[model samples]
Target: MTTTTELSELTGDYVLDSAHTRIGFVAGAAMVTKVRGQFDEFEGSAHLDGDDPSQSSAQLTIQAKSIQTRNQRRDDHLRSKVFLDVDNRPTISFISIGVEQVDETNFKGTGDLTIRGVTKQVTVDFELTGTENDPQGRFRVGFHGKATINRKDWGVSWGRGLVSEKVTLEFDVAAIRQP
Candidate 1:
């Protein structure tokens, strides 16, 4: 277990442990059920300023072609020009513009999120889950965050009445501290 002081002392650079982290989304389908999908390939880094949270920053890049939703047909369609247009805009990215610590275990991050060549501001609220040292002897930190966005804002206006406009982005992140 890590104490509050220990967490504050953990000021350093870290990389997302992609194998243990999940970047997923949920969107309403046909105004009834919901569709869930996740990106299989992504990389991210963060510079944490525990003592001065405002100085912290993070960036992430996700492969657009890696979108998976259990159904190959739907996945392939998502990558087509009608939706993400993965061939032309192969990656989605985010870069933090500001960060604020709401309390001991909460934080809010505002950043520019680019999807399908469209860039927009997004704010994600995060909760610190915990910290631990894995068997590999690496320091790891966990956080869960989410944000709601409109697909049409990014020009993903294909299945209008079929697919809901609002999509919720979810993140279950595990970051390992660098040496």
Candidate 2:
């Protein structure tokens, strides 16, 4: 397994800290309102080898029902039929096929992101927030990743005029190194 390290540092496996991580999605409804929500139970892992950024990989699993918003009614509607059908897909996931260093704290990686039973290639923009050991000596690392895609491309165009074609997905998943 891989643990946390520097961009120019060594590589290993790190287990995601579900308690400290969040994966959010925001989509525009018409030109007046926006719909926002998040997946509740998500786990992510990254395998980064200092020698080969190309060899690095990432994977994330997000529970659908965890979706939420400022308004409860709207959130319910989104989870119902107008948007994500949690019963059908249940879980949204992203499995990385490749990763490349854009610069320090930045990465441009290509992966297959699945939402609402639709999978498409998406280039993720990620930033690492360094690593630290807890009082128990367990190493934890922070990461923030983002990407945007056309809802129509993935058969997810449920709300046309009410929702924007472009959906922005962001992730703030923190993982710990388990020795």
**Candidate number achieving the greatest lDDT relative to the actual structure:** 1
Model 1, stretches more than 4 Å misplaced?
Answer: 1-6
lDDT of 2 by residue, 1-179 (tens): 24344554436788788888888888887689777777777787888766778898888888877787777887687677557787777888889988888876677879998878888899988887667777788766777888888988867667668789988988887777757
Q: List, residue by residue over 92-136, the lDDT tens digit for candidate 1.
A: 999999999998888999999999999999999988888888899
lDDT value for model 2: 0.78
Clashing pairs in 2: 1-13, 2-12, 2-13, 2-14, 3-12, 3-13, 29-162, 30-162
What are the lDDT figures for the candidates, one per model? 0.94, 0.78
Worst 10 residues of 2 by lDDT: 1-10
For all predicted structures, in order, the TM-scores are 0.97, 0.88
Supply the TM-score for candidate 1: 0.97
